[model samples]
Structures are given as C-alpha cells and as structure tokens.
Target: MTEVRSTPTQRVAPEEPPPSDPVAAAWTDYLAAARQLDGVRRGAATAAGEQARSVQAAREELTVVRARLAAQQSRLRERGVPAMALVPSPPEVTVAARSMAAGPAAVLTALRTARECADAADGVLDARGWVAVVGVWRASRPEGWPDRLRNLLVYGPLAVLGPVLQVVLVLTGSGARIALAVLLGLVLPAVAFAVGWVGVGRFFRPGPDGRLDRTPRFGVLVCGVPAALCTAGILVAVLTG
Candidate 1:
C-alpha cells in the first residue's frame, strides 16, 4: 500500500475566492463608517462639554455677585438707612478740575458745582426721556424669540380663533365680512394692549441690576400702531368698495 501511494502523489490546488465577497465588503464598509461616526460623536461631545462648563462657571459667578449684593443690602438695613436713599447714583466727573488751595471754601464750591451738574442730569432723565432711552436700549437688544409662550397656553382657543376670525372674515361675502372686520377692528387694540403689557414684562425682566427697568414701549408703538392703521385702512377699503 505504501509503495502504490509513493508512485503517484498529486497535490490538490487551493480553492479560489468567491465571485464577490459582498458580505465581507459590507462588513468592512460598516466598520469604516462606524469609525467615522464615532469620531464625529466624540468631537460633538467635547464641544458640548466645553459649552456646559462655560455656562456653569457664569452661573456660579452670578450667584456669588447676588450673594454679595444681598449681604450689602442687609448691612444697609441694619444701619437704619432707607435702602433707596443709600443707593449711590452714578459718578459725576467734571470737565474742569481746577487746582484749589486746600480749604473749606474750595470744598463747598466743588460740592455746589457737582450738585448742579447732577440736577441737570436728573432733569434730562425724566419719564419721557427714560422711555426714549429704554427704546434705544431695546432696539439694540436681540429679538425673534417666541413671546409669552404661557400666554399662548392661557389664550389657547382665542389665539387660534383670532387668526381664524380673520380668515373667516376674509372668506365671507361683503356685508358679513364688514361686520366681522369691524368687530376685529375694535378687538385688536385691546388685544394689543394685553399682549404689549405681557410682552413688556419679558423685556423688563431682572437684568444685571435687580431693579425693574421698563422695557422698550417702542415695540408696542412700532408693531401695534401700524397693525391698527392697517386694520383701519382695510375697514376704509371695505366701506369704499
């Protein structure tokens, strides 16, 4: 038997690869994509972590400042001084600083000049002037956020109805349309007043200073007045038509 096998020893060739190892290719491709996705996820996570840390730091700093302010306020109260009276007004720097001989007379003169300047500044910052300043401040502030989202909840169906009313009035034939138009015409200003008052609170919310500063009333005037005028124009058009 050993001799017969030794006479002819033919080696079998290795098997060829499959036509297309699609499953293998797919697995390799999936692994490559997974690697890329993991890299992206890691990068995003790092960025989000950095932003979170920054926000936390700012919040901590604000808390410290608030605590300090509260302590100062308590101290002021303990001294029996009215808190409003003790709150320091902004510093007044004079244009002219004359070198005076160190004396009581010089001190008195300096005090009088400073007081006069303060009075003038105060006169400039009355209600109307302050309203103008608030307008300018509000103008510079960013917008385009959803306003009084809670109001949307409270007004619910009415909010839906308000738009629907307009749509219905628009669709109806002339006479009924005119009636609906007139109703909306009267309702709009009161709606505006309510909305504006609610909106003002968002603008006047506690800023850096804990005091309540008036929000820009200008937004109301800017948006509401024009809307009212447009409604009136529509009414006029309807009447004329």
Candidate 2:
C-alpha cells in the first residue's frame, strides 16, 4: 500500500475586483449624500429603476450559477473524481455564502442578495412615487386668492376705466365728443399695446432658455381682452345715446 501525503498548497492570487466607473461612482456617492440630507433627488424614477433591475438580474444570475456549481460538484464526486480539491469555492461564492449565512436562513442560496435587491427597489419606488405625487398635487393646486386679487387690481380697473370715462363724456352732449372719441380710439389702443408689451415682457422675466416669451396669452389676458370689452361697451353707449 502506498501512502500519499498532502503537499503544501500554492498561494493563489486574489481575484481583482471589476474596474469601477469613476464619474458614475462620484455621482452615485453624491446622490447618496444628497438623499441622506433629505435633498431633492435628481433623475429619480428612471435611474433608480435601472439600478434595481441590475441588482435583481445579478442576484438571479448568481443564484443559477451557484446551483449549477453544486450539481457539478455532486457529479464529480459520483464519477470518482477529486471533488474535495476544488471544494473551497470561488471568491464570489465565498462572499455570497458569508452574507447568506449571516442572514436569515432561506431555501435559495441567493436569498440575501434577493432581499437586498428587494430593499433597493422598495426605497427607490417609494421615493419616485412620492416625488410624482407631490408634483401632481402642486400642479393641480389653484392659484392663491392674494395673487388673483393683485392681478385683478392691475388689470380690472384698466378695463373698466376707459369705458366709463368715454360713456360719461359722450353723455354730456358736448360738441367736443367727436374729437374725444377719435383721441380715445387712438390713444387707448396705444396704451393697451404699451401695457401689454411691458406686462408680457416682465411676466417672462428669467424665462426658459434665457429667451423672453413674447406669447400673447398674458398680453391678451391683461390688455387685449379688457381693451376690446371696454371699447365695445363705449361704442354701445355712444350709439344708444
């Protein structure tokens, strides 16, 4: 009978970790710090979702590979091969095993990773949902009474003033009525146009893309509609009288 003695094991070089993306790491760290400080999230929904999916996919893949490794080990043992030689397991498998053992007992070897994946998904989903809900609520909220009143002060009186003054002057039956009408017709429109130009421009201050919005919405709301209504009212009063 020949006795075989175990030889001293050769030191295997450690597996180097996968190279990391520096800019991505920096941004991720920054985002984590921001989140810890309760700051607003950037790229909330889409980015978080992708991260969760990546983790889940990794966990699933690892689970499948580890299961295959176990079956392969069993097959080697049944075939009278030296199964115990490679029994120590790979570094990735070791780390995963430690985490799994340290955690609650589970049927699957990748349960620890799966739980981590679930947690990551939950946190991101909650944050994204909360941000969306707040955004929608803010959008749907009506303008405050104070702002509306302030705007009315700026626009309402201007609309009524011209019509009232013209009506009063026309009712006086003075020979100057014709000249007054001509002056009002030209001057009032010019005033409305000037007011519209200034109001609309100012309303667009610090506008998007550093470009001023010259849209007629504000101008029409503040000046055009009022001027039209007042002019119509004045015309009606003059003709009826």
Q: Quantify all predictions' global Cα lDDT against the true fold.
A: 0.56, 0.59
Model 1: residues with Cα > 4 Å off, grouped in runs: 1-168, 200-204, 214-216
Candidate 2 residue spans exceeding 4 A from truth: 1-157, 217-241
In angstroms, how far off is 140's CA in candidate 1? 11
- Residue 12 lDDT in model 1? 100
What TM-score, to 2 decimals, does candidate 2 have?
0.29
TM-score of each: 0.28, 0.29
Instruction: State model 1's lDDT.
Output: 0.56
**Model 2 root-mean-square deviation:** 29.8
* Model 2: per-residue Cα lDDT over 1-241, one tens digit each: 9999999999999999999999999999998988876643456665677666756766676676567556555755664769557466698677766766633233243654555665565576568669988988855543222334434444555555655666667677774884485457546755764664565445434333565444444444655564556556666765786
TM-score of 1: 0.28
Give the per-residue Cα lDDT of candidate 1 at 60: 58
